[model samples]
Target: MATEVLFYHLTSQPLEAVLPGLLMKCLERDWTVVVQCGSRERVEALDAHLWAFSDDSFLPHGTAADDHPEHQPVYLTDGPDNPNGAVIRFLVDRAVPGSIEGYARIVLLFDGQDPEALAEARGHWKSLKAQGAEVTYWQQKPNGGWERKA
Candidate 1:
């Protein structure tokens, strides 16, 4: 199946407040997720954040530094490798995906307040569109839900 690429422009909330919900949705669908970041610092920060982000619960995830990455429902990395065999991949921290094949979904979540992130996302959209890829853009609504804009 062709991979569906989604660009999520985060306007109403920051990533910390928004990511967990999306990951939960993917988990609900029984899809292992790979969240690729731009740096090891980000990997570490997310590793800790996912653990303490929730008041009553936290998303079960691990990183390459973990003993068993393959068993983690959500695997965090800064590379192109899919250690957990994730069907849905998330590209964050301005991390660009190397390839879009062999996945059910490719989600790019960018900060709407960052000019550079916005520009980079636009570039990705144009490049992917030119390649005849199935791409769509979604914006965060005031209510913190997603609204498809393209």
Candidate 2:
């Protein structure tokens, strides 16, 4: 079974340089990486690159009900009012039994602030971990980016 790792970083800093390296690692291990970025354009661009790397890779956006692959990298928008709304629901649903039963692991990434978003995400993380799923978290700085709040 693949180890589930939720690698998330929320900062004003662009993850363009960092993401490729991370993806490369996942590819090496043949791990299914579920990534969520706040910016649509950025995620779209990343998706394009991902497709170039792996034809089997898929990036579907928006709610699962309306989710359809658009080109490559899957990007989702958690609007101010809807943060942790659709994506969280989708992950929780997928993590449930039978849906993605064979999935060795589940990973969730999100902006680590916005009390509402983090609260909801934390709940899901805790529940999954309690069920024996390895849970990990990284929080970004609240002032401007995901830096340590100190």
Candidate 3:
């Protein structure tokens, strides 16, 4: 099956703030998630952030150091492996997977303020669209909401 690609252009908030909400939505629908970052440091940063992002609640996630990845509802990694059997994957920090297969959906969030991230996201958009994938683009509105642009 073809993977649906979603481009989330972040202009108002950082990934640390936006990620958990999306992950929560996925969990609400009973969909597991794999969050892929570009480096180990980013993975660690996100790991820490996710744990403390909210004071009211927390998302259930794990990393390689946590062990037993197969049991985690959300898996954070710098690599491409989906140990948690997640049907959906979120790519951040300019991380690109080796293959888009084995995923029902792929969400790519980029910093609208960073030129590098913006360029990389556009590249992925063009590449994936040319390959006949269903791609959509969404930009953040002023109130921290999303509006589909494509």
Per-prediction TM-score to the true structure, in the order listed = 0.96, 0.44, 0.96
Report how far residue 52 has shifted in candidate 1, in Å.
Answer: 1.0
Those runs of model 3 whose alpha carbons end farther than 4 Å from true positions after fitting are: none
In model 2, where do residues sit more than 4 Å from their true spots? 1-9, 12-18, 32-46, 49-100, 140-150
Give one digit per residue, the lDDT tens place, for model 3 in 22-100: 9999999999999999999999999998888888998899999997999999999999899999999999998985577
For residues 60-80, could you state the per-residue lDDT of candidate 2 as single tens digits? 333222344332233333222
16 in model 2: Cα distance from truth in Å?
Answer: 5.3
Score each candidate by Cα lDDT.
Answer: 0.92, 0.42, 0.92
Candidate 3: clashing pairs of residues: none
Q: What is the lDDT of residue 70 in candidate 2?
A: 34
Candidate 1 lowest-lDDT run of ten: 125-134
Model 1 misplaced stretches (Cα beyond 4 Å): none
